[model samples]
Target: MTSLPMSDYYFRQFEHDGADAPAGRKGRIFSAICQGDAPTRKKLATDMALRPATVSDLVMELIHDGLITESRPAQSLQKGRPEILLTPAPGRLCAVIFHFVSHTMHCAVVDLAGTILFETTEQVQADKIDKQGFIDVLSSLAGKCTAHIPGSAKQCGYALSLPGIVDEPGKRWVYSAYWPKLSDFDLSEVSETLGHDVIVRKNLNCELRARTSRRKSLGTGKTLLIHWGIGIGAAFISNDRELVLTEGFGEIGHCVLDPLSTVSCKCGMIGCMEAEAGLWALATMSQDQSIPINEQKFEDYLQDCTDKSFLKRPLLLMAHTLRNLTLTLMPDEIVLTGPFVQCPETFQRLTERFELIFPEGALVRKGRKPKIVSGRRSKSDELVGAAFDLFRTEIGALCRI
Candidate 1:
């Protein structure tokens, strides 16, 4: 039998003990609790090398703060003491998520457990609104939703998901042709308007990638997601569980797919992916061909379209785009998400073509064949991710306090 290394065994034991330790105890306790079953105060104290009294005090504080709850003691037949488990109390906390798209915005109030309590959407010409005007609108809506919560002003936070480049840490949107004036504006203003104590802003695609990668339905080992909406972009998760967010990454839509193609993109580029497979491209193509379609009408007609010529052109262009994305990322699985998934046939045709092009060997050596699937929770994913972002930030504040 091979003996485990002493360092490994000690580290494992330390992790187990850290679960119920005092505040000064290493962060290992929190890490273990997040990944493993709840531990008793005694076990946590032992692992953290702290006194039982200290563990008790810390656990009580956490419970009182609404961060966790102590459950009923475990059933035991023996005459010994029983152990109570700790679990997160999702209801005591809440978060607000705003998914800002080119033509509309989706807003939701979600709990810590990722449940969407209420949701609202509005259609507006995003390009026409200035920085403060957009913030005012978002703030007004958030105020209305949060008012429904009964409390002494619940701790609130906002998550902004947008399509253009964002300075994540700086909380500034560098550029987004969809809303030009939004560039160089303090995003915290939205939080002020909503009366939220905390605010977070992230690139829409990057936030989507983080949310999808964590979903169990998508199957958790390194995956990639490509969203085709007003723009086309890709997000990647590495095998080591690292989220790679490059400066201005996943701007494939701006890349010239065909310089000869006549379509012009909002980025002022001709024949780019945004000019081809993007929703605008598809909408333009349909309209130019004299197909009677509007945003709402297109959704209805897309399901019953019988003309192969009309369907074939867009599907082929989408397939080509997917092929290019696959060749570049070689993701374990490629999930097609976003507004486009609403059209089931369009999604199905794209998947069929992807499979046909790379029958085998794609993501094969990486332990699984890359599979293409549609976004399961279209609106839910964004809202949940936004909520989690808020919850996580709050947790950090509590730790500091």
Candidate 2:
């Protein structure tokens, strides 16, 4: 099935009581400090055009609420009195992240500071159960993880990353090639089961791309991430903000790349990007050539390709598929990630082909070119991004207040 447009997927509705509280003077002050390098009441007040008294009151409230922590006094540069610095209190709150794969579910617990304290992976019986069974397992896992958290944090939020079209508006799993029975299921049942105060279910590719966009080390601005796994999915980020969330904007993998090609995608389509570049595609291709290609073999092949010595037909096909995607999207940078990107030779050839196709104008201008780099935090990006989702929500709440 063809994916829906971004405009049609705004199903979920979020309301904040403090969103219209006359822009609390103290809240404004807090926002300025939170957005800056070193938080100072005086500077915050000045930035927000509020009185120092108001800023001080807001600072005290934030400190008392365990949201911000005071640091050592700042060194006086000019002469007068030194000022105290404030920063976000790390680990004050935490979030749980679940990435639903084709045959397994990956889970992690992350702190407000974006640290993954724990993670686990377990194989799932994808073909056996109905909707309720999937929800029960996921909910049970989330409950267990939340209970395992060391402290007595009251607000526990969840983020689920799954394949296929997620109808955020309907809070349902619209479609999945791997989990066909889950397509029409209302996934929110898991949230209700866990009883978490806040729950977010999003496409895994979108969450991954959001994590990549928020990575400070990458220095990425606007970019597209192409994740090749059980399915081919894409995520888009512009100007450091995720524009595709809840909008279904990055279902490029489901886009029909070849109308007449005989290859069929799990989504019941022919010649889709997923059919072309997905993990199953590579595995199928490898098996056809009698190249033993399970998960371990896939990893070994990737290592060989990365070393620049291997160039099998399957790897070449993967490269050509990526090249076509890069040409079509023309994102500032196209990030090839997920398990498929593990193949070194495949990745190199893909990059080589990408350069060959666009050459100079590929992704960037001379000095300002977008660099395609390997994802460093493979396992943690999703969890960190999930934490960031809550962080953003909290920030938005503060803004509204």
TM-score of every prediction relative to native: 0.75, 0.75
Q: Could you say which candidate leads in lDDT? A: 1
Per-residue lDDT of candidate 1, residues 1-401 (tens digit): 11111112112333433344444243344333444466667787777677878668777776777656677565766576677776545566777677865467777777655566777777777768887677767876677767665472244577776666566566667666567667666675555566665445445444554455455453446566666665667666653433555456667667765668888776666787777766666767765464332334555555566653555655676777677766777676777765556688678877887677656665643433567777643555566545554555555555432
Give every collision pair in model 2.
11-169, 12-169, 302-343, 302-344, 305-344, 305-345, 306-344, 306-345
Residue-pair clashes per candidate:
1, 8
For residue 199, give model 1's deviation from the true position in Å. Answer: 4.4
Model 2 RMSD, rounded to 1 decimal: 7.3
Candidate 2: tens digits of C-alpha lDDT, residues 1-401 = 11111101111112222423345444444444444677677777676566788677778877776767777664668566678887766456667887865578877787655566667667777767677787767776776677667673434577776666776556667776677677677766665677764455555544554454544554435666766656656666654333544557557667764567677776776777666656566557553453333444655655654333323443445555555555555456667666556755456666776566546764443434346765522555555554555555654454334
- The lowest-lDDT stretch of 10 consecutive residues in candidate 2 is 3-12
How high is the CA lDDT of each candidate model? 0.60, 0.59
Model 1 regions more than 4 Å off: 1-39, 43-51, 71-85, 101-106, 117-127, 152-156, 174-220, 244-246, 287-297, 311-313, 339-345, 355-369
The residue-level lDDT of candidate 2 at 256 comes to 61
